[model samples]
Target: MARSDDAIAGSAERTRSVRLALASLSLSMLLPSLSTSIANVALPTLAQEFSASFQQVQWIVLAYLLAITTVIVSVGRLGDLIGRRRLLLAGLLLFTGASTLCGLAPTLWLLIGARAIQGLGAAIMMALTMAFVGETVPKEKTGSAMGLLGTMSAVGTALGPSLGGLFIAGPGWPAIFFVNLPVGLLTFVLAYRYLPADRKGAKTDRARFDNVGTLLLALTLAAYSLSMTLGRGSFGGLNVALLLAAVFGVGLFAFAEAKAASPLMQLAMFRNPALSAGFAMSTLVTTVVMATLVVGPFYLSGALALDAARVGLVMSVGPVVAALTGVPAGRMVDRFGAHGMTVAGLLAAAIGSAILPMVPAQLGIPGYVGPLALITAGYALFQAANNTSVMADIVPERRGLVSGMLNLSRNLGLITGASVMGAVFAFGSGASDITSAKPDAVVSGMQLTFAVAAALIVVALAIALVSRAVSRGVASTEPGAGA
Candidate 1:
């Protein structure tokens, strides 16, 4: 009877640990995801407060994005070599401290610098959250846990604009940054208390940090992101030089990784067709989704004559639907496998993107909401499935590095989508200023952008299909193949 009682207590303790881990992981995912979109709504206010031009104000967002893109892979590798839990806790502390700095910044440059630091923290947390989930949960429960993470991300993104508005209206723009304080502190405490200790094992002890490779990768990503962000708007000598530097940096990174004792990113990983295709599809899908999001407000306000409040409300339907469907989609991936779901989701997104141009501006909110929701729902399905498939195939030791690569693809897609779509919109509208453009010109620009987005998704779908076929072929050849 005493043994039986002890067994029961042990089971309860294990369950409690899992719950706490999930809570901490979810909050870790939420903070970065929320930060990505939250400052967007505050951009205009920030510009006014600092007396900055539109181009200058953009640095507020770009700085964060650039910082994350540059360091995510290196940090992820660091997590693998050292310990994910340690990295996560450290990241949380940095993020919280940076948020405090952002809130207190008296100058625009100071605010941008603080945001860059915050992004570094965000990159660390983002890189490891999935790896943490995979490590913490039972293998059978990974999909479900990832699903919950996806749901949190969707919810955070959807809530950012609304929350930003509330904070700005109530406690002022600085409150938007300040609000992260309590949440970050709470999350940090939970993680420190409940997260499992790193195992003292062979893998941890054997790996050496590759400093040279890390530097090359960082330089490559920074130059590439800068070229894309700046070159999209204009083709000046500086942009051209940056683009050349980015290309050179990529070549150098590849060469350095090949020679390094312990490469930051395994070049051989790209040989895994499923992994490569998954990363490509991730980038493409993000490009489609982000392009729509970047152009959405302009389309609504310029073409439909809606106010900012109404536009934000209308635009939120996509994320709400995505959040609602994320869990179920994840379960489906666990049951049916990622290939079919990814393909189906990409098709749905393609259809939705194709339909966007057809939505009459005269019909306004009702017409736009349905298609946007469809696209977001499709995105949720694809994301959950793709993430599961990608991580499932990676060796446990490399989960952190692969997670970083996955996020890197996403950030790249976002940057590319915004740059490419923005340029396309400008060309289509033939207007220097989107806000003051005529309705017809704005509508035309939006249509062209959606067409481009649809084309990108279609390409992603084709790649996904090919990957599925290859995956199936490999499985047939190796009956014992996992995932």
Candidate 2:
């Protein structure tokens, strides 16, 4: 009787421990995503305050993005080599400290520099939070953990504008950065108390860090990001040069990785159809999402004749849908399987995208919001399932690296969507300046962009189907399989 009672108590304790760990990871995820969207709301304010041009103020956002893109993969590898918990703790501290710096910086350039540091901390947190799931949660609960992280991320992104607006209204633009102090500190405390300590003499401890590959990859990513971002809606020779440099960097990085004894990336992992498909599809879907973000506001304001407040209100639906569906989608993944859920999610998103361009302008907000909700909900499911499928099978030692690549793909997708999709929207609108495009032009541009977005999702669906078929064929060919 005593033993039974003790067993129940132990089980309860472990359940509580897991919940606390997840809370820390959730907060970790929230802070970075919050940082990403929060500052965008403050950019105009910052520009006005500093007497800066749009291009100069844009660096406030760009610096953070570039820093995250360049260092996310490297930081993930570092976490694997040293320890996720230790590195994550350091990330929390850095993020908190940098947030303070951002709030206090007197000059625009100084703020940009602080944002870059904050982005580094955010990169570490983003890469490792997913990696830490396998270490902290039970094997069967991987989907739930992924879903929870996804929820926090969506909540953070969704909350950012409104929260930042409140802060800007109540206190000032700087308050947006200052808000992170309390959340970061709380997350750090929870993480220090609940996260598992790194094991002694792990295989990761003996592996060498790939310095050449890291430097090359960072430079390559930075070049690519700048090439995509720097032109302010118009491409120039500098963009072309940076793009060419990025291409060369990729080839050089690949060569360096092939020669290295301990490559930062296991180049061979790309051959794993599942991993490849996950990364590719994530990029595609996220790119499509960017179309909505980049183009939706224009459509709402121009085509539908909505005010800024109304446009913002309507835009919030996507993230709200994502937050609402994340946990449920995760539960579905646990029940149905990641592969099928992934396919289902993609199919739903494709359908939503197809429908988006067809909604009548007369139908207005409801018309747009309904399809947008479906797309966002599908994305929530796909993201949760896709992450679970990949992360669940990853080896303990490689989780950090794999997780980092996953994030890199998502980040790359966002950058691509913002740049490439934004251009597509502009081209389809047939306007030199999208801000002054006609209502009819905005409507037509939205249709064309979403049509293209749907096609991208269809391509992702094809990849998922092929990957699934390949998995089945390989499974059937194994010695024990009779089929």
Candidate 3:
């Protein structure tokens, strides 16, 4: 009887340990996404210090994004080949080191390089964390665990600007990088202590890294990002070179994926209509979402005459609602299925986006806040529904690859969103050409931008609606279902 009691106690201890590791891993996965947007407010400070142009400062953000975007799929494939834990730990360590470098960098070019390294670390963390969760959790509880991870990511994103504002206000910009120091240390220690090792039972076979494929993918993304950067400029020789590189790289990557035994991107998974459509919709949704992240804060502060802190507070509302609303949405998805929830989410988001342009310039806080809440709620529901559909469509073996691909698609969409919206605003406002513009013009441009974003979301809604027909009708028609 005593031996049996000891065994039970050991089992309980293991469970507790697993839970702790899961929580830490969740936080680790979340911080990078949070950090991406939170630091935007500090760009001006970095620019002034380095005597850099706005275009150069843009690279600070773009470099990190480009690095993550280009390398994530390959890193995910590598994680599967080796152990996820090792790659994750290595990623964390590199991230910590890169953060210190970013804080200490003296020049914009150096900072850009550091950010690129930082992106590499972020890619490792992003790729391995979900795979680790899939390996750790029980089959029945996988949905719940993923829901929690998504919630963490949402909350982190919501908190980023607010927290970043505080850091900037308190001790200037370096503090933002320093903030990650303690959190990274704690997570590293906790993960090491509690998480299981991955050397055993991992795929160990004859596998060779596809060097040609990796180069092609990297060149493709880099060229595409460069083209966007130079879009505001004249179409000269450099622009033509970048455009050609993008085209050639894309062709090469496609050819490689088709021929390689283990392609970095598992294009085969798109065979599942539900997963494919879900990912496609997610990409479009983020195109809108990414625009909002960049444009919303700018409008609230630049046009609405709010302070940085207030902008952070206001911008945070949508993601906060999303983090909170995710659980119930997940349950609803499980109970009903994907079709209804996704369509409803898209429609709701579209409505919310439409409301943004109608916000009265004369109206007070409550007027704007209400529409913000609607947008946030809609976005939350959309994310929950989309995540459920994509993850559920695939089995456990491919969760890492799927998560990586989903993120890559979302990141690319975000880049596209920011670029396209910026272009529209630049052209429509007539403010982009001017070195310094009046507040009124800026506001007018923002209003136009918001209207266009709304239209884009409505287009997303139409696409999602078509998805319902394609995916065997809406799933929310049953009683108490989501749609």
Candidate 4:
């Protein structure tokens, strides 16, 4: 008789030795999400204080996204090769120091630089934490544990705007980053005390990082982000540089990935249709969800005549629902597999997005609830199922690399969504404040953004369906198909 995975995980989690290790994993997971959100509310304040253009103010956010996007895959592969614990600790310390710098920044440029450093730390922590969970927990428990981790990030994201607003109202912009200090310190202390050392059987693979490949990838993303940031701004040279960087970057990285003995990422992972679709779907879903998160607040406050606090309250609905729905989605993944759940979620989200622009001003608060709730539910289900399917499809040894790539897709999606939505809002309202616009124009812009978001979700659904077809093809050809 075989021993059950749950029994093994239970034994492990019960051990005095593993308790602290679990705590470390929890903190590593919590801090990045917290840091990401902690500054959102402060953006407006930062813009005022630094006398920045709106595009410059956006760099304060985009810098973090770009930095994290560039490094996650490399760091994840490293964690898989070396050890997740050591890398996680290093990331924690770096992140804490960077947080201090962010709080003290005297100029927008300095702050953006500090935020980029913070993102590097975040990537390290995020990649290793997922790898750590995958390596430490039993197979039966992995989905649940990942779901919990996702919820932690979601909570942090939800809290960020409101908490930042509180700090800005009370002590000004510095307080937003300052709040992270105590939380980070506590997390570090717990991590050092509780996390376990890597098991002896794990291989310490000796592949050196492909620095040239890394640089190309970095340049490519930098250019992409630059183009997004400079939208309709006076920066033609920057745009040209970005275009060249992307073409050269992809071409060089592809050549290197194929030749390297221990590639930073195995591009072959995409050969699995389930994994491929999951990655693509991850990108699209994140782009739509994050774009909504970015734009919804403006829609509430700028266009609808609500204040900052009211916008925060209204915007909170989606993440709140997301947090509630995640665990249930995880259970469904275990029972039904990733494809059906993901497709259903995407469909619902598309419906929700389509409804958002149509929400009449005359309908009042109750009318707002329906579309928002549907969007939230769809987001929760899609995120949970997509993550599970991607992890399940990958080999255990390479989980870190694969997980990092998936996360990169999501973060890059965030960058695209923020940029695109910002451009859309800028074009439509022309009123710097969203709520002050004519009802028709506001509705038009909101409708256009929502419609684009819906289209992206539809794309995700199509990918999920295609992946299902591929999986069925593989299964049908197996030895037992005729039996």
For candidate 3, lDDT tens digit of each residue in 1-483?
999999999999989987998887787778787768666767887888888888889888888888998888778767776666777788888888898898888778988899899899888888777677656766455555656776778887777777777888789888877777778777788778777787676664546566677778877988877775564534578877987989988888888889998676656766666777767777787878776776676567666778876876777777887788776666665566656777777777778777777777677456667776777677667776677667664554566677777777778788777777776666656775523556566667666876887787787777676765665544545556663
Ranking by lDDT: 2, 1, 4, 3
Winner on lDDT between 2 and 4 is: 2
Clash number for candidate 3: 0
RMSD of each: 2.4, 1.3, 4.7, 3.9
| Global lDDT scores for all candidate models | 0.87, 0.93, 0.74, 0.76
- Tell me the spans in candidate 4 whose CA falls farther than 4 Å from its real position: 1-23, 47-57, 106-108, 170-172, 193-196, 201-207, 232-237, 421-437, 478-483
Candidate 4 C-alpha lDDT tens digits along 1-483: 246888887777666545565666766777787777777667777889999987788787778877888788878877766666677777888888888899899988999999999999989988777666655566666566666667777787788877777788898888777777787787778767666676576656554656666666667777776765565433477777776777777888889878877666667767889888887888888888876777776666555767766777788887778777777776776677666778878988999988887888677555666898898788887887788777874665677787788888887787777777766755666655554677666756777788888888888888888889888999899999979
* Model 4: residue 427 alpha-carbon error in angstroms: 6.0
Number of the top lDDT candidate = 2
Q: Give the TM-score comparing model 4 with the true structure, all chains together.
A: 0.87
Best by TM-score: 2
Segments in model 1 whose C-alpha atoms lie over 4 Å from true places: 202-207, 475-483
**Better model by lDDT, 3 or 4?**
4
Which 10 consecutive residues of model 3 have the lowest summed lDDT? 470-479
Question: How much is 350 displaced in model 1, in angstroms?
Answer: 1.0
Question: What's the count of clashing pairs in each model shown?
Answer: 0, 0, 0, 8
lDDT of 1 by residue, 1-483 (tens): 999999999999999988998899899888987887899889999999999987898898889999999999888888887888888899999999999999999999999999999999999999999988777888777677778888999889998999998998899999989988999999999999888887676235435888888888888888878878874466578867877998999899899889888778779989788899989999999988887787898998998889977888888887899889988888887788777888888988999999989988888887888888889889988998889888986776788899999989999998888877888988888898787999999999989988988999999998988877887788778956663
TM-scores, all models, native as reference: 0.94, 0.98, 0.85, 0.87
